[model samples]
Target: MFKSVLVANRGEIACRVFRTARRMGIRTIAVYSEADARALHVREADEAVLIGPAAARESYLDGAKVLAAAKATGAEAIHPGYGFLSENAEFAEAVTAAGLVWIGPPPAAIRAMGLKDAAKTLMIAAGVPVTPGYLGEDQSEATLTAEAARIGYPVLIKAVAGGGGKGMKRVDKPEDFAAGLASAQREGQSSFGDPRVLIERYITRPRHIEVQVFGDKHGTVVHLYERDCSLQRRHQKVIEEAPAPGMDAATRTAVTDAAIKAARAVNYEGAGTIEFIADASDGLKADRIWFMEMNTRLQVEHPVTEEVTGVDLVEWQFRVAAGEPMPLKQDEITLTGWAMEARLYAEDPANGFLPSIGKLEHFVMPDGIRVDTGVDQGGEVSQFYDPMIAKLIVHAETRQEAAEALAEAASHVQVWPVKTNAAFVMQCLEHPRFVAGDVDTGFIAAEGSDLAAEPLSEMGIEDAAHRLRHFAARSGDSADSPWHSLTGAVGFRANAPTRITQAVVVDGEAHVARMLDDDDHPMTRLIGLSVTRVIAFENGSAFDVSAFARGGSGAGNPASDGSLRAPMPGKIVATPAKAGDTVTKGQPIVVLEAMKMEHALVAPFDGVVGEVGVSVGDQVVDGAVLATVAVPDAR
Candidate 1:
């Protein structure tokens, strides 16, 4: 085993790698950008080095800086944890040339599977089934349009170099193909420095099933079963489980055998994933599953696989990189009980799932389950990185047991100030179809509104009112006042109305609650940010309610005032409208890119664009005015 290793990444994955390295008595080195100087991973490392600025291109993605940091720290090996330089073939070769062990698949294997079109070609030659698509080298729009027509409507335009759903779009008709291809190519160039894309026939009912394959330097490969990542939003996996819920013995055998073949074709080393898209309109069939793409590094959902197989995948990576033989043969590795993982992100499901960046004033995870997190109380969720703050994994004797336990655990999460999708995830786990395992890639989008946080119940409102009164009575008032008498009577001015109503803000709207509070009431977790303000966690949702306050003077509602403002700090990626350009309601006015996602600020009503305050590539702060629309006067 290597005596010391450096993780060329940050956040939960970095911390995750360090944990395994520590257990094996290997010293862990962490590299960080200026933004992550005080990050959890940095604090946990045996030795830390500052690489560059907050921007990823200057820091995490800079291979030279990472190599220099490793050399300076005397790290014997470098583990490119998941993202950043993980799949960069040049970076892998650079590490080896620098006389440092690259704890990942060989550079050749990475290059083989790096591009989707090329990978599919290799797979087809190796007798591995691949999805039907156009992987031609032509970069012309005319060629792409013809290919889309050949594949029929609802073809998927995917960036040949894309992952994480960044450079992929689904076109339902010929008229939309040009715009979709342009969008995909633009994102591909921006993200991967490759403007090329491929056209694939869209599976109407696709279930994303990926097999975890590990290969050693001694030309030995084995499978660790499979994971079902069908619960997705915007093509990103939200929840994942091991040994797919509906997978049968025959289908499992076929898929696992094909995964091993795919690995052997590349002479793969270390850890990789062979993702397959299944046509599950009927049920999971071996012949219906086709190769989608290959992830040439450890995945974000590797924990679920680890739980089911009782294997230490990170340790396997280390061993394989050290030229060790396979830890166990394919026959020895067995799947035990089921495991489920839910990505807990710092995003508001109720607000278009927009990323929420702030200090975690009260961050707490539930007990009795595994929680892998990078941020703690008082840590900031910066806008420079992925918004995922934690991963909640649960394992049980059966699939249903695991799902129920995970749902219960998700409901107990208490994160405030910085909002999270804990409530949304809980709802997903508890949804009838989800619980019954009738799921596909379209699950989240199909049940979006139903999965959102429902309004606080009447009992919940009454509970909030009581808690407000309890907190208000405890502060500022004298001991001799009616508040200390333990009575339900509320203190008020002599000239006040007989039925006093206390105003409280929930989800930015004000609600009136008559003050008829009992001194003692059973309530959920509630924290007072101020005497007048308290955030209540009811049914796993955070409600920031302020007593006796009307409204906050932040950005004006665009529907009423025609002012489209930035909801958070982000770069203006596109301005689709300019001054005097007429646009209809809900037309995209400005597209703000933040936290690795695009949010469109749209026209609130049919009117002419009055002003476009920001230009493309301009970075604006929270609540900054981006654009406006004006109502035309009668002639």
Candidate 2:
């Protein structure tokens, strides 16, 4: 293997590669922009290089800068970890031209499958069934709408450039076609810098199944089974599992064959994935599967594939880049267990799953389960990158056991200050539909609110109250303590009937909590559930505090009040108003852009912007509002 390789990406993916490379005794280099100066990936890698400023266009997207970094670091090969330049055909070609090994598919393969429209055409030629839609080279809005009509109602308008659901829209009827097309084109242009689009027949009750394919310069290729990425939101995958459930032996063979066929059609090499949209209505029938696009690089959920096949795909990448042939033959590869991966994003599920940004205060990752994260506690989650905290992956003998493990793991994950979708992820893993193996692309959105519903026990409030009450009793009556008496000597004494009453808003309902704890009974009562564990933490100075978490039901943890904010880290594209500015409901306030996607922060109700803490182009995190609205008539 090569002595070293440079990962041309940031966040969890870069750190993930570094972990594998370090184990293989391969020195790894990380490239970071200004925003990622203190990012975990940079700190973890053996060597790091500064590429450019925060904007992806000037930094990670700059292929020449990456090549320069590789040369400067003496990196023998460059691994484009998933996003940034992973699927960029030109980047792969540039790396190869610079005499650096490209740890991905060949430039020809990338070019053939880079654009969805072109890839569909190639898949058709290769005899792999494709979704019947419009892949023609017509850019006009009228042309697209006409094509959608010809194709059928409920067509999906997808950006021909980027995948990750950046520029995708669904039209349920002909009347919604024009507006949806315009919006898709606008988002596509803003995100990918390409306004081109393709219309495809929307598979009702679609199941996203993709096969992992590996090849070498010797032209030898083999296929790894499939991953069911049916649990999705806004066209982006939220949860993925290996060896799709309910897939019979015949359909599995057919889908796997189709995936390999699509790969061989392009003469693919290195690690790539052929994604197919299967109509699950007929239970994964051979003829019901159609080609979706191919991912020309290592996938984010590659761990699930590894868990089942017991293969290290990154090692395979390194071997291939070093001019090695396929490591294992078709018959050698085997599925040993089931695996599931949940993308833990620093985004709020309650607030439409908007991106969240901030320092990870007391960030506690779930144990037992594998967590690949690029951020540590106190590291700033910048507004110039993806707000993905980590990928929580677990492997078990069976899918049910894996799901149970994943659910339990997510429940224990603690992200302080910044809101996360940890609880939301757990909810999905334990979702009955998911457990029963009856899920689809739209399952999450279809039943998301119910899944995110709050439990009635108010247990978390009771627990937090118990902990805070104990701290307040001995809390020195100093200026530092909010409840401290002015005398500066702890007003309340230890075990002296600590009387505390605080009201907190839970799910928009204000609830009052009264606690009384004395020497005889140090802990408070919850009517039925008893407080088993209490953790105390000391903040800056004399601000010592403790937290009580109730068991049995996860109802008492105090997290950021559910807020839809920035999803991934990015710059505030636009802030339209100042403090005290009255705005109507649905009025756009802050336009945040991350991963080249723009998300509009809208007003929840007709109210005045209370505070203008940030300005246009300001970098804000999740819940860090460019402007906050004043609740009407605060009585």
Clash totals, every prediction: 0, 9
N/CA/C clash count, model 2:
9
Note the Cα lDDT for every prediction shown: 0.84, 0.76
lDDT of 1 by residue, 1-635 (tens): 78999999999999999999999999999999999999999999999999999999999999999999999999999999987899999999999999999999989999999999999999999999999989999989999999999988899999999998888899998998987887789778878899899999999999999999999988888999999999998887899999798999999999999999999999999999999999999999999999999999999999999999999999999999998899999889999999999999998886678889988777778888999888886688999899999999999999999998898888767777788988899899989999999999989988887898665443444444455457646555565542233222112222223312333333333223344334343222223311334444544566554322233321222446888878789888788789989889889899898876677788888988989999888999998988888887610
Model 2 agreement with the true structure over 42-115: per-residue lDDT tens digits: 99989899999988888999999999999998999899999879988888889989988889888888888988
What's each prediction's TM-score? 0.89, 0.81
Error of 2 at 491 (Å): 24
Candidate 2 residue pairs in backbone clash: 355-566, 355-567, 356-622, 357-622, 383-569, 383-570, 385-569, 460-555, 460-556
Off by over 4 Å in 2: 453-460, 463-592, 602-635
Best by lDDT: 1
